[model samples]
Target: MSKVDVYDVHLVETVASTTDVKPLPLATIDIRVPLPDELIHLSLEEQDSLERHIVRKMDRRLMPIIIVMFWLNILDRNSIANAKIAGLPKDLNMNNAQYNTCLLIFYVGYVITQLPSNAILPMVRPSIYIPLVTCAWGLMSMAQGFLHDFQSIMVVRFFIGVLEGPFFPGVIFLLSCWYKKEELIKRIAFLYAGNILSSCFGGLIAAGIIGGMEGVAGYAAWRWLFIIEGLVTVAVGILAMFLFPDYPRTTRWLTKEEGLFAEWRLSNEVAGIIDEDSSGIWWGVSEALRDPLTYLFTFMQMMLTTGQSFTYFLPSIIKTLGYNNTITLLLTAPPYAVAFLGSVALAYSSSKRKEFCMHICFPLTISVIGNILAMIVHGTGARYFAIFLMAFGVYVVYNVNYAWVSSSIPRPQAKRAASLAIINLMSGGATHFYTSYLFPDNDAPRYYMGGSALTVAVFLCAMTAITIRFYLARLNKKIDAAGGDAEAALRANKGHTETMKAFRYQLHWWTWPLPKALGTEVISIYHTSSKSADAAKIGKSNFIATSTEKWAEKHSRTLETILCTFFKNGTQLEEYILMLDVGGIMVYVEIPESALPPLPPGLITGNNFAPRESNTASKKEVLQMFKLKTDQKIKSWVEEVPMENCIEAVEKL
Candidate 1:
């Protein structure tokens, strides 16, 4: 009997014998089939184009929302400094120490909440969590306008900190979820540009509010600053709820195909490690705590934050340039504006070259020089130029360092989230608390002590960056040497994946194109049971194997000719799977019976076949059987065959 006849008879008998069990649905099974080489290439090209389109769409939809939110966040948080210059201290009866204490107190709430907030981020929708906190902080910021004394303002600031704490780290975590490592730094820089622009324009805005509204409606100018900025923040927060895209996996804005592609691309980049589950949050935290690099990076960030603390006392620093309230605030604008431009330039260069270390080292070294010049330079022009250097260096370092943390710790999403929060909390808290004391009211004209301290911090940050570069280098070497144990090496780090064998660390000064150099290798294994007709026909004979170029050429013609002859009516395979084994290209075709011609004399038709009992064939057992067959194919396929004939036979199967 023919195979089709035998299969039909077996199907009828199987249906009659099984009272409850139903035949497997075609939709439930993923049918694997071979495609023409040209089609495969076209699919890959289409996927690449799709990825670029998705990334662009994400940037358009997500970037502006985060930037605006961050702008409001920075404005609300640091408006206190502007308010301080506009008479907050005098109005509130705050001594320099009390003011510093207020800054420290805000960080007290800020520091305590970061880790927990980031840990909880995956469980709650960001659309809800982020805006809710934003609105809360805005309300708190506005409440600062009603403060009666040091204690009242301090309490308001504390709540503002608590509500504001999750934002920066949360945004960083959010960006990391959407962007690949190579594409991350630029996005981070753009997000931080909002912070820089706010600093620049915050002063200008504060100047306007303070100058024009000093006593409007019986409210102080500083009060007007807080109230206006806070209300603006609240309005923006409400808008954020409607604008912000949640995690890529769950975001509703993306089409289903785009979402899958986003997930697939990210999985491929990180070897299939994605952090989606809340159950892994604590585990991620533990992993972060156990990694020594976490502590090292934390220390480095602390020093960088200390050097960058100049932002808080910027008006004071510029006031020494012999400028009044409005002029000092205006002067503060230029340095940050210049730094904004510098940051974008540096971040773009880093992303393009795929280099992280030198970008950091170069700016930090320049910042140290700027600090030294600020301490010793006598001329006003030279001093102002020094401020420019200081701003550019510190801001660039801050931007790059944040990106570094995100890229270096690429694994278990929860751990990355926790690590970012912990690093930001520790670094920012220490800087706010301790660096506040560095520039007391007594050290006005040239805060030589502050400059010197910043010099040391910048220098230490550079050293730490070098240390991290070296550490990554060592890990990359170990990964390279792992050979078949590469997966084991990745597992040791808790992020092993099929695509990770070629992974390498991005080192600071390394000039190699790491991704291209490492290359991708894939192994395809095809398997079938010994009792199968195809298995009997082939008997242990190896199938075709060839180089990618030759195979592509050979199979391209074969598939083209076969389809032209057999599929002239435009019929095509409906259920098929395309598997790409990357490095050495190999195509394994599993032909369906309908596509083949009658069997030869030696091969038994389906009449000799027996359907496995439904009770015995549990889903798990069936899956195992399929896996065993695939494994056998992988092991047995060791010889080459005529590509044209194989294609013809597969088309006739």
Candidate 2:
């Protein structure tokens, strides 16, 4: 399934008199030609309406399913924290230190399969893939209820981590596949808020089951906690198998027109090439590995996830407020509930404002302040307020950064998938190996040791995000300089597509009215240097440059033509007021104010001798400026052309 994009030019012309040349209308320049058969006949406004309807339909069908799946993911992964307070430690004869080991083991198993699973996801149906793994996760989590010893529970937790490993990155990759970067952040927020919402409810669910279901059917309430949550997860997985949407190209629910538009719209974003089909799995892995951003994101995510170490111990931290198990679990819900609301609001802000770094850093700052205050403040009320600050802050940091990673490296779908997997593996799995120890028993009440280390990590997380923001901005500046696609832009020196990108291909076709003296007569001659240059070399080109100012200096009929250039909206010669002495007639060209374009070998390779811009630069400076010389001619100029210029340099009679 490969798509090759070829272009057709649709142009409009405005007649200009010898007195004035009006700029071409904007409709004359848009040339993403050969719109698909489904959309080609529609008016631009009608096409826009259809695109909106299709995207709205996609969001309606996909978002809820995505949210629920993540909710279950969070529910199954974090329920153990609630179980800790439900007396599972006493039954299994495990201490707080050993419980941390259980948490560490899950990550150990979780990291093992991530890279491999992500590689396979593109080839599989996500509707089938996500649910299948989820079902396995539920089975392992359910087994935790029957475990009797620390060793056995460790095995179950490890597998739970393994089964859940691919999910977060997989979902992000899935969403990125269907939507452009601008359209994706808010959706990611909903997905992330699902997990935060799960945390809020997991506590309440634990309180009810552990409080009322104690000794139910000869099982402890902690045992029932695992059983019930796992069962609900399994049920949710089955439902997803039916309702979950696949990739845009594969989703059966879309109309044929909608499906084509879905794929076409995404292709338009990445220069008419579909990302999923651009490269193979191993190639994508190589791209991800070679990129330095991957490692930076890994380090930053590791720090952020480490800051979130609090979530694993929040139940214990809450219990220190002199409350019973049920009340403590109930108390944990409000902070997370507040966090859920904040995460969604922050996501909306990030998407609407099109910002990521500050959105991430602000919440992390709040969490850092909360951690510092929790350590210094001694009273119950002061500590609880601190919890409120931290709860919302850390969750937003997590939600916002995920969208940042996806948007920053969106080309060649494989590269994005592998990079996400690697970042999550190191940040989510490897870091937890030590971060799990952040909340040991001796650090209870204040947990100063864990709190301080995590505060530093959270602070570093913010700093790293700030650094990444500047770094990505630098990358963007380069892309802008190269035109658009960084690698493809390298060919800008010679290729048609690349050249068009270099000048952004926006141009006006104004009929150049000849001067009155040339209306009824003709003149012709060739410079000695132009013996090799001819009309064949010029071909049918989009731009023409002319100057007649040199006619005044030439006595009779020495210079044949001063300058003749053909190009689209691009580079230029030196002064806008250039002229050529063609035999006895004068030829003048009006180049738009833009960066100068490269002159053909038939014309002189001279733009340096004349003053670049004059008279307000008069829409002439932004175009490529050119200079004329009789002795040396070039096929094309060596310098790269920026998109701002669209004036040509030419002379003939």
Candidate 3:
């Protein structure tokens, strides 16, 4: 018979004989059927090729739409800043502080909606939720064009903030659902590149509208900017509802085999904990609140975001060089364009090296230098150079920091969603509430006070990132000491993703101990055997007995000496036989003779073995007697061995 037919008969016979016996629990049964060679034994090159294919497919389908959505998201949210330079504040009869209030009020709605929006994301279809919110915000943004006074603009801005609040955090959470941690940084940087590019392109678009559309429709150029951008945003939002893939497991675009492979890859990478169900927003919030790193990183993000708030007033900052509105708007694009390239390079390095802290710290340090230079330098050329440095530094830090948050909190999707939203919400508040006051109109043309505060914030951000790095290092050390068992780390982390035995936080630098601290090797064994032998000649019970006897024979000398020596001294010796199946091949493993406990008298040893006292009336009677004794011994061993340890051993097989 063919090997497949023989195994099929064995399985059927085993099940039929056990029909009247109590069924084992599903977890206790080894039900994995053999797979075809093509599925089970793929070459490394084949695996890599498949991975590349999946990545390319995902990138082609997902990235462009996501990037464009983010571009529209940023353009709508920050267009007010561009409009201000085009005489928006003057046209609306708004003063400097009122304009800042408008900025600050938007964040009030922004902060209020973040937690709920993120919490609701997993419960609703993202394709529907995200696009609906995008469309709502687009309408609100368009309403800005019709507003004639400060209060009306503030109302529209606030509603726009409320509707737009979910997009950033929602997208971050969505990306995490599809990509592994190692793949996340570059993807996030690419998504963030959209934000940077919008600053560049938003400027060009705003300038074009302001220059050409000023008198064409009898509406102010600033009004045309809102109407045109808002219409574009609404259209994209409508399109994205159809384009966006929801999640890897649920996405219909992939074939069945591809979907299973994708899920398996992710589950293995995450140690098999892929929590898709919502565990409740409050539960997620509670978990995040308990993690002290959440507070530290959130505050760090807030400070970093607060310091980089100059992007909102880039036109105003450039205008300090005494350029006209058109020239100033055009000039704003170059710094952000430069920063986009810098951000991509930094993100690539971070992803390649699998590091986070250094990527963040290095950039923030450069930003600190830029802030100081802007404060000390008087020349326009020197100041513009300073702007380039500041823009590159702050934005790269922003992109990588969010990636860090996602990697650091990878499980129990609810908590991850909560943590991301909370950090973003607070950062938004900081951006508008604190950073707004930093750049008062009175401090224009060299806002020394603003620069100094930003300098201090950037320095604190660096210090905080370093501190967080050290804290994770300490946790890693504890994990290493526990023999790299994630359970120990989980105990220490109170069941957070930080305890995921396989998860490691990226450090600022590669240290000698970091690799050992981050991960440990798990040794595995596999055994293969031919299955063409006749079942009667090589029966399961006889094979097990023969294997056990052969193993005992190999260690006979040590076993006999130990048992004999112990028995002579009026003591007993105990030995154990551990049975395991590796790769469908049965193995009988014995404890080392030296480590065995005292054995009982008359136990068989290779050097001194004798048949047990028995009277055989018939061959059947003697055979039955041998079987009963062997069964009893096996039963005793099963009763003594810990079930948990047995389960663990089986899992290793």
Candidate 4:
């Protein structure tokens, strides 16, 4: 309703009519999160600062509790290993076979429940759901303290697995809910750091409890270990419900402005609302079952898990290096510490640069070297160093792969949820049953059979990662060749129609020799359906919303003539989409160098441009909106007419 002068704005090109836009399905639109005025008027720097502040607050409040909960998660998971070294087998009258069974049993429960647990997460408040599960596992861990036989302990371990099953996959899904694809790996690194650091510190804590608390309660030190760790976990779980946030919209602590930005930032990232799915969980499962990426990612996870099976036996491995049990436990800390630093560093780089393949593949290649060295090397120091490398490679993949799964298969929160569970089901769950036997003490020290299997797994893991990187790169080029409908190209496996439009898949970009640019631009204007109240408010008469598509469809000659306008002076127009949404329709055209000057006869800003609090918005604002939404995929924008009054002016063109 106000004039936005463009004499000084560098962004708006002199386009007379609507051009092409991104394809936005009707299901993805949500109008409740309108742009805030204070935010609307700020310089880009101020907006960036506000975004950083929101992330900072979210991290401060969210990460520590997540870290602690996961810390307890892993601490409880590995408690059995620490218990084994502290006379758990001797006291419980069990052999190595029984101990391995216990290990396998827990994972059985853990894997089985994950798909269902993640499916339920969206239906419940995460604050309540995550905590409730954490507490259930805590109770199961405490029960491990009272068990009298291998049978009882195995039963307890299975329940512990069931209770703990959802934690990691669920955490991956939860983190994806809050972060952008670019922001995901770094946050996930911090999340996995809980698992990594627990190995470092959990060893120290278990060593202390097992060594000190043995005789105090007239109970085995191993029992004291379980009892104490379980108590700490229960306490942390209770605090989590109060500390953790659910989705941004439902969270209580954010200011209205903060809440709006939180929602907008993510909505802007996906070019759609990624909230709950109206469809059932099975539909998501079907979507996941059909995506080729799901199987590829699952295989990668399986290799990574099998490659890192040494984690279950690191204590025994170090003990073989001439240390006693206690010293062996202490030695486990250093490698994990190094892995933690490496992981956090890699995660930061991956997130900052928004690249994953090299970050992932290169480390795994190093692991291959480490695995080879372990197989042939005879010296103690060299063996220990190889162990460090082995530990580093797989855990790093653990975080990166989860982030990749979330990013690559993103959407239908249900599909994302199901995909992760289905993946972990094989890699984290079923693989454990076999990996548990790979390092039987009979193969200790050299354990060439175990080391050999692990080496191939690591090598295959690296090659598979490289394969995926190139496959994705090829797909990006194909989508470009097809135009810009990433939505259709990605869903091609699901019987969706193929069109000339494609989306650039942005995860990692290798220096693959891509062809030089033939210019193409797209502008998507997303308007609510006509049945919605917001449709009437999109523009006066809703011409751009309800009838623009029809007009364009009906008037082929008029559209062809309009297209002819930009094919002037030897410059060309490649292709574009005209998607109308609650905002405005976006038109794509390349302005020739000669088209730069002279105001049109009647211009008073633009209408139905990017999401804004007021139509008093600028071209710069619209481009900024796209920059935030597409992560700069739609970097350059042609302006829509500035006001509804200009609708007449646009028609005159």
Q: Which 10 consecutive positions of candidate 3 have the poorest summed lDDT?
A: 1-10
Minimal lDDT window, size 10, model 4: 1-10
Name the regions of candidate 2 deviating beyond 4 angstroms: 1-34, 488-653
Model 4 lDDT tens row, 1-653: 11111101011111222324332211111112234565665443455677888898888987889988998998999988888888888889998888888889988998889889888888888888899999989988988988889999988898898899888888888887777776777788888888899999988987788767878768888898899899888998998989988887778878877877887776555545456568888877787787777788888888999998888778878888897667878888998998899888888877655576778888898788888898788999999999888888877667876777777765658878888888988888988988888888777778888888898898887777778777776665444334335555655535222121212345653220000111122111222133223322222122222223463334222221121112222221211122222234332243332553333332213223332121122334433443565684543444556677687867775
* TM-score of model 3 (CA atoms): 0.72
As for candidate 3, its clashing pairs are 572-598, 572-599, 573-598, 573-599, 574-597, 574-598, 574-599
lDDT of 3 by residue, 1-653 (tens): 01100100111011000111221111000112222334455433344466667778888988889999999999998899889998899999999999988988888888888989998888888878898898889999998988899989989988888998899989998888777777788899999999999988988888888888886668899999999999999999999888888777677777655655565556555555565645677888888877777888898898888778897888899999899888888898998898898899988888765677888888888899999998889999999999988888888767888888887776778888888888888886545777877788899888888899989989999899988888877765555446445567757767354335444455532212111111211111111112212222222111111213344344323211010101111112222111211111111121222443544454434223322221112323333444665686532111334776988766765
Give candidate 3 misplaced runs (Cα > 4 Å): 1-49, 493-499, 508-653
In order of appearance, the predictions have TM-scores of: 0.72, 0.72, 0.72, 0.73
> What C-alpha lDDT do the candidate models reach, one value each?
0.68, 0.68, 0.68, 0.67
Which residue segments of model 4 deviate by more than 4 Å? 1-49, 493-503, 509-653
The deviation in Å at residue 378 for candidate 3 is 1.8
User: Which ranges of candidate 1 are over 4 A from the true structure?
Assistant: 1-42, 484-487, 490-501, 508-653
- Assess candidate 2 and give its lDDT: 0.68
User: Between candidates 2 and 4, which one is better according to lDDT?
Assistant: 2
